[model samples]
Target: MTNLLQTERLIIRSWIPERDAEQAFVIYNDPEVTHFLGKSSRVTSIESQRQRLIEGIERMHQRNNGTGSWAIVEKESTTIVGTIILKQLPDKDGLPTQDYEVGWHLRRASWGKGYATEAGQVMLNYGFSVLNLPVIYAVVKPENHASIRVTQRLGMKPIGRTNKYYGIELLLFQLDAPVKIEESSS
Candidate 1:
């Protein structure tokens, strides 16, 4: 229910089951959308999708560390185009890992626009500014060029490939917060 950030054209808001479950189902189940999203196939049940939303909500509330997914909505249409996630990768035991991640999944209809780049900047800013995280990571499937482009536009550095984190091979990109330079009058 919390509105996390707002861009010129998109509103990145929290994942609320009562408000976002149905659309979340649509986004998660679309094959084209899920094509690079790992071994998971199109989710078949709205209930299951609702559960995922519930879990995301719980996770967002669990830590004041600014880790979770938010719904990306277009301001004019007020449509849920996709989601942007900023969270730490979980360890094998499902606990938070050292590497924090920033990623996005947009509707097929929403592809090719700058929405991902715009929304991603907001999330990255939140990670660095609000969360005070020194670095944030983005792990993408090797074949997912669109997302790669998005991360690049956000000024993230492509570190290397890694299978250790997400249980699958991914091209890991990282971005450190811009250092603040205080002004001093001579």
Candidate 2:
């Protein structure tokens, strides 16, 4: 399968839920992991996880613009470490907005290993270089310190809290396209 993006130690690609569900279950089924995310992000059963993955696959195809969910696999062991996403923000009414957002979720064991930051950086490149997006946003719970640190590592600037998206208040971070410096011929 083609990779959406890759870092030095990870491959970001399509989610094969059937193959990834058990590991994914270990992540999404954990209350500790799902605390910052809303209730709908939880997977109560293998069947529900399958349903979510099916929906995610469909969403990946529908976007056709490198915007959607993807599985993050570690290169060393070929294990699914987590999920990374570049999706349009939805308004409070669930209507898709032009604003694109980047996010990630890593398993507990994978935390503190920098997978989220690495995957996020590559997706930001894909969004800026391939998709030509001028800016990308990330919505995080104010209490999600680890994710906030990741956003900071990605050079995303905090734009303050917003209630315009997700029907819940969130701290908004924005990353603008890097300015290209043209070299002058001597």
Candidate 3:
């Protein structure tokens, strides 16, 4: 699998063993970032976090054939900002499904800068074009206006509402492949 994917101002790439633990701690520790996520159980050690990252990578490989949560980095500084995940979840029918779900979280400092939207678009394109997914879904807390706005910007429309993994209410949005336009030669 390719190590890096470039966007206008960001680089979406696989996590390196060296950086996995540090990044995991950032996500697990930040309250503001983890608010909608329910808890703030900071990863105590880099090693454990690294192990989790390794396992996550392995699961992604096993399931999706090589695509999963990508570390989001700034292009200029190459600093790890956050993560973008294309997770696979089961459908209501209790059967294995192939829906692509998009999610993101960044440091407080990175909020309000349009980075989420920018990175999200790249992932959405990859989902539809590279992954050839028919639809991409996003689940956000009803009160997560920031994420709701990001999903809207990506052309995702609200599909329904449901209880999330942690039993919290969530709003579901989806974006399907854009309709192709044909030109007439007169």
Show pairs that collide, candidate 1.
none
Model 2, span 55-86: residue lDDT tens: 88887788777788888999999988899989
The candidates, ranked best first by TM-score, are 2, 1, 3
Residue pairs with clashing backbones, model 2 = none
TM-score of candidate 1 on Cα atoms, chains taken together: 0.93
Error of 1 at 182 (Å): 1.8
lDDT of residue 159 for candidate 3: 83
lDDT of each: 0.87, 0.91, 0.78
Q: Cα-based RMSD of the predictions, in order? A: 1.6, 1.6, 3.1
Tell me the TM-score of each prediction against the true structure: 0.93, 0.94, 0.84
lDDT score for residue 99 of model 1 = 82
The TM-score leader among the candidates is: 2
Q: List candidate 2 stretches off by more than 4 Å.
A: 182-186
Q: What is candidate 2's local distance difference test score?
A: 0.91
